[model samples]
Target: MSPDTAPSAARVDPKLLRIAFILVLGTFMATVDATIVSVGIDTLAGEFGASVAEIQWVSTAYLLAVVAAVPASGWLADRFGGRRTWLAAVGVFLLGSALCALAWSATSLIVFRVVQGLGGGLLPATGQALLARIAGPDRTGRVISIVAVVPLLSPVLGPLVGGAILGTASWPWLFLVNLPIGLVAMLLARRHVPAVPPSERRTAFDLRGAALLSPGLAVLVFGLTEVSHGRTLPAAAGVSAGLAMLAGFAVHGLRTRRTPLVDPRLFAQPPFGAAALALLVLGASVFGTMFLLPLYFQTGRGLSAGEAGLLLAPQGLGAAAGSVLVNRTIDKVAPRALVVTGIVLILVGTVPFTQLGHRPTDALIASALVVRGVGMAMVSAPVMNIVYSRIEPAHLPRAAGALNLLNTVGGSIGTAALAVVLQNRLTARGPDIAQAFADTFWWVLGLCLLAAAGATRLPRTHVGKS
Candidate 1:
């Protein structure tokens, strides 16, 4: 069978399932590691005898490094082949984890996190490209739907798992826990992951574009974070510089005869454009809420980290249910229909959060989270399926890279923006933190509506059909 199309089988191929399972191991490790360490921030500060500000670099460094590395994933996969690139990425991540476990100080740990982020950033996009290529358009929706849940669920699970580990063992166990899962993934990948040949028309690496795009994205994320922290001057400088660099890259991408890092022109295509917009908004709504809820639980409700994590479990469960639903209906349903419906569900779930001033019951909150989780699963899988199915097999790498980059940036901005709003509201309405959170949730509702608007532009037919 040609790589572009495969015969639709009654059941998903067992071989494809094995490959996706292996790839998910790597992605889950990367995603989970990002959030897991968040739980240990105070513990890390005490362990290293550093101030909270300094200890924060451990997470910030990882984030900036991830942003910087994302754009190059497509090029690396094209140059090195997907299997080689993925294995190498997993190896690098494990190396970083080991180094982090051995670090003697906050500075050293932060530096090592950068190494891990570079590897971690590449896994999701590269893995998606590889799976899509193997599954072909016909099976892409089902294969991706099944595997996507791991990384999606990781953010919620990370804090819970991190709390458990820290409660039982010392902080080193936080990093060390990755060792077993990663080792198993690497071994399984070596044996089961098939090699994908590099693109035939390998253009020269776009060094100039890389300099502009990668740093632009990193600095932009840094700026947004600073804005969240209310660092006005530094945030302004960072945001300005980042925007200038990105503008430079966009102009260069249009003019350059050589294949730019990620073609600016790809977004002009109808399906790709709408799907990208939807993903961008979805990222903002989902991650912004993630940033908001934890603070709400800990500060407003006076719950412990473990308690908050436990309460958030319903969202993960809902996501699992949504994935099962999408996997079954994706082939029969239009992308626009699924995505729009998902947005509606998200809005319904989010409505309760906007009523925090009433002191909504824990049961009410958990039910809302379940609805929100299912909605998220619905949006992500369909948007991704649309992109993977519409693009040619060879373009998968860059396309995947662009989508991931947008989503990451969107999340960063959304979290930062919401943080700023929450801060302002708290300052304005002094003793009423509940009302502040309620005010902030209205913004999340706005994002979901915006996503719904974009979904209207998504392909109206079954994307899996050639």
Candidate 2:
């Protein structure tokens, strides 16, 4: 925001700026809903008198439906047009939100949430496609900076908002709040988002590819969550069937002449593959921790939901600051170096969480969140720059879809896995709630370390190699 950098930041046209607003609004509503409802789980459980395992479905169902829709996004957008498709998606999400607010029981809420997820999944995939198309190849960092804001900023605020609503109003308002925001997003899409008319030149829809990947991913995520919940037979069946279908899709994409829906071929590129892995690790680290952080404050530290939310706001603020600083300098260094640096910060920032005890000071926790936020901004903001700049422009939609799916699945699985770990540790560790939660933080730290190491595999720059 300094005078020197003002012009570079303003490189995108007014039309694209308008489009970016629409995309970010959709992305914020979709991504924030995934976690905002997370804080309300226990409240919903109490309201419906449901068990912990049963209430989990309220969140898991939404995530699974998101996975189901992810593989179809690129093709759907291509066929229907991005602007039209985005508007429809926002409209569907709004409808789902309204229905969810009216849910009379836990089962009703879970079903309505699935409806929300189906629409939510399209927002990020199409949003990224629009962003990449507008920014062009050279200015990818700018688009990434724009696209990254929603994910980095929303998680910090979601719990705070969810907590405030639950504490003041009611659980239903959690879903109801999205209604006005989503309507505004849909309205903006009309003027800003360009309608890509179906191209005679575009590849035919790969029914085989769609058939294989979408359900494959859905069942795969379903199986993982079930396994986390300690269900055996159903989980086994789902995992086996899902993996086989995904394997079938990979083979189909390789042998067929037509383009695949979720092309396995994109992973072959070094930069693309590296960015995908980075995204997976980033997703796992950010979301898995987001899933746990509020609980840690509320349960371990005995803070109220509202207090816990206020405690976590620093992370979002730090991320906003980090993005501004990192984007200004990202192009000068090799992405590998920059990404690794971000991971190091993540490791450092996250280390503090694993060591907290009873009645930890507020400043200590907020500082940790601030550091982690900045770390996340550094990693997430520039990754799409590496991916979009490296891939062929025509492949943008599919590539965008595939990467977004990886993130959703990675984060969901990571969150579920960590929750399971926390459950087991609480039982095993003699009810030392702080230690059990700390044990879960160790798992988060492991994810960050894995991500940091993986970032080194990204293509090296001449300066980086030297």
As a TM-score, model 2 comes out at: 0.90
How do the predictions measure up, each by TM-score?
0.98, 0.90
RMSD, one per candidate, in order: 1.3, 4.0
- Positional deviation of residue 1's Cα in model 1 after best superposition, in angstroms: 6.9
Per-residue lDDT of candidate 1, residues 308-388 (tens digit) = 999988989999999999999988888888999999999999999999989999999999999998998899999999999
lDDT of 2 by residue, 1-466 (tens): 3211224343666766677777889899998888788678889999999987899888888888898888888887777766677788888888899999999998999999999999999888888876676566666676577668678777778887788788789888999999888878777777656565443457788988878888898887788777766788988998899899989999998888887887777787777777888889888888888878888887877888778788889989888888887767766777777788888888888887788755466788788888888888888767777776666655677788888988888887787678778888888877688888888899998888888766887866621244
lDDT (C-alpha) at residue 77 in model 1: 91
Q: Candidate 1: what lDDT?
A: 0.89
Error of 2 at 353 (Å): 2.0
For candidate 1, report its TM-score. Answer: 0.98
